[model samples]
Target chain A: MTMGFEAGQDAFARAVTDPEAALPPGVTSRRGEADAMRFAVYRNNVTVGLIRALEMRFPVARRLVGEAFFRTLARDYMRHELPASPLLFEYGDSLPAFIEGHEVSESLPYLADVTRVEAAWTRAYHARDAHPLTIAELAAIRPEDLGATRLVAHPSAALVRSAHPAGSIWAAHQSETVTPPRAWQPETVLVARPDMEVTVRILPERDAPFAQALLAGEALDAAAAKALAADATFDFGSALVGLVSLGAFSARTDDEDLPK
Target chain B: MTRFDERETGLPRRSGLGLKPEHYQSINDGEPDVGFFEVHAENYMGAGGPPHRWLETIAAKYPLSLHGVALSIGAAGPLDKAHLARLRTLVERYRPASFSEHLAWSTHDTGFLNDLLPLPYTDETLQRVCDHVDETQQALGCRMLLENPSTYVLFEESTIDEIDFLTAISDRTGCGLLLDVNNVMVSAVNHRLDPYAYLDRFPVERVGEVHLAGYDEAQDGAGDRLLIDAHATEVKDDVFALYEHLLRRAGPLPTLVEWDNDVPAFDVLHAEARRVDGALAAEAARRNARAA
Candidate 1:
């Protein structure tokens, strides 16, 4: 008996993703015979198209591991987790976590963190558009009320805290001639698309806590206290200015009135 | 409003090129003399970005065709309502001259498979496709052109002919057809059918637009010629001949040159579009000669 349309599609989809699976029932060629080679076209399209998407999304990861190893990793990752959405750009959200658990982590401990940075970069690129708060707007706020101000993070602002020098690693791979980082240390990278351009900046380790707190909607005084507690020498004024210049915060719309 | 008329494509009868990011700067600066520009709807689904910015600029200058690659109109289940809503939003935003999708399915129970997969032609599948088309047209408040698929494999249970199946869907749903000539060559050669005969049988009156692309050749399991719709290289001579033949019958239609994979520089793509324009002009001259 021939399989119904639904069952046949179910089987065809299964075989398309899984190279080892048998050809779906009722699938044939002009010769009226089961043709694995012809069916392999669909299989190859799904796998290769997805692998290319991953390569485009994470060029740094692909470059670090080489094409062959990256293809192997992507194939294994795809087999377990196919994209559930049509938005290919948003497909590999869980890849960083997946890489963390994979055996590659033992060899390259920073691979997962680098993938996280790349993933966050993609997220920031596609995040909703908003007018980034300008430094001029910050200067307008009264000094006494500034500490109570809860500046909103830009829609595209994202901070990826890594135990490895993932930011330096990603930056090195951007150019043709890559220079290895002089010293390997933990880094916190900020990914944001304030206006048109997506910028990746490595923040000072001492000020990461404050940036994280501010991005989390904490009041300015509280965020400053968090940074000061982490490092006694942390400068609140400079860090706030650096983040504002990086377009980390959105313009104040809802909270226009100062807290009296 | 009543069902959309097939003649109301809102696109000029000339050749266009698929828009690519690499060519955006050149397109913005030079503003080449192409008929229109087409983009994959999913690429612009992002809320706000350079893609949207460039598209907004280009759409203001030229006609836009919103082509969708992942609607999975042939899927057995109901259409994805969320995706349909997204399409509606895109339509409202761009107000493109024409919109199209494939007759193939890409989504299934598992997830969206990126490639356009073939389906069996049967009464059940036909009814499902018709329903999907109706829903899509109603949701977007505009007619859609369903392009035929390039298949490497066929189903033994297929009861209806491909051309007839397409005609039936268009007739039932009041949707128009997008006759992809390259797909005809690919499918005909793969299935041991005649390309010219397929064109002859196609309902050209219902065709709102046309597509021209290149295909990569390979061999099937039985060593038979298999053609993959790679859309990577230049349009094959035989495919161009088939397109010219289509032009003789359909007259000048809103044609698009699609090079999705391995996209070349703007000059190369523009050169291909110029070649298409040459054929279209020749066809127009012939039509005038006949009228005169």
Candidate 2:
């Protein structure tokens, strides 16, 4: 039976993403028969196109797991979810979480974290452009008012804290030969596009709380307190300078009405 | 019909190439003399980045053609408002010389399928497509060119001919057509029809631009020839011959050489485009000689 356009599309889309499903109704070949091979072309295009998009966004993950395994993981992920939007770059936002629950996580414990870093890097690369806060601007605040001042995080700034050294693993894969990291330790990676270039840096362990709080919109004194509570040796003086140098904060606008 | 005279047309009657990111530096440094450069609209929908920076530089030097792949103009539902807003933003930012989209649908109720899937060419779909073209033209506040699709399977329920369907859309909406010679070749072979006959029935007067690309060959379930519209290699010899045939009839419309997958160096693409330019030049000379 012939279906309506909407029904036809519903059937076609269902079959395109599911290999086991039959071809949609009303589809035919010139010879007047259902041609599965001909229909397979659309199936291949959608699956391969989406998988390739993921591969392009997460090259390091693909390299780490090998192309065959990465495709397997991507295919598994596709079974549960498809892109809700046409923006291909933003399609794989949930891939890290998907990988965390997959059985592959048992074999590659750090894979999900590495994917998180890769995902954040892409977000930073495409984030809105803004002028980064300068050290001079920070110094302009009165000494007494500094503790109460709220520094705005750059739109592109993202913090990915991992129990594994995902940042070092990601950096090590940049070259042809992948060498083992010097030490296996936790890392908190900072991703920000201060200017045109996207910068990815591993934050000092103790400063993670401070950067995290500031990024979450905590005031200067409150963020510093969080860092001190995390570690007694937390050096607030250098961490503030380091984050400003890294362009983690946006230029402050006096128009914002701060609450008392 | 909305006839775009020589002055009204945006693209020059020469050969162009699809702009790839790998060749951005080469294009910037060499500043090659070509007709224009075409880009996919969805690729630059991001808020800000190097994509915009490079596009800004390239658009300044060349005539930009914005081709949208994800608009889903043939969908059964209303147009995506957010996607239309983004397209409008892109048009405003680039002020491209030409804008075009496919006649196929990729978005369904579930989500975007990311591939140009086919639809039945019945009177129902024809009215739907005309409505879409009208909506898109109004949204962007500019005329759009709709291109034909290469299909693997046909719909038994389709009552209208592909040519008639496209002609009706153009006539009803006053939109232009983009005749992709490769798509004609591919669709003809898959449907067991003569490519020349398809071109003979095409509304060439309304054509604003032409697209040329390569197709991969395979056999269907019946062991008949099946051609996939894979833009991974140079334009096939048969497709180029068809293009030359088109130019002879259409009189040197703006042509674009598209190589999306397994892209080669800038010089290779430039050379392919030069090959097209050679054909366009010969056609123009023939027209001049006839005039004399």
Query: Chain B in candidate 2 has what TM-score?
Result: 0.97
Stretches > 4 Å off in candidate 2 = A253-260, B1-8
- Model 1 residue B258 distance off true place after TM-score fit, in angstroms: 0.6
Tell me, per candidate, how large a share of the native contacts it keeps.
0.81, 0.78
The TM-score of candidate 1's chain A against the true chain A comes to 0.96
C-alpha lDDT values of all predictions? 0.92, 0.91
DockQ of 2: 0.82
**What 10-residue stretch in candidate 2 chain A is worst by lDDT?**
A251-260
User: Per-residue lDDT of B44-161 in model 1, one digit per residue for the tens?
Assistant: 8888878888999999999999999999999987899999999999999999999999999998879889999999999999999998999999999999999999999989899999
Steric clash pairs (candidate 2): none
The candidate 2 chain B region of ten consecutive residues with least summed lDDT is: B1-10
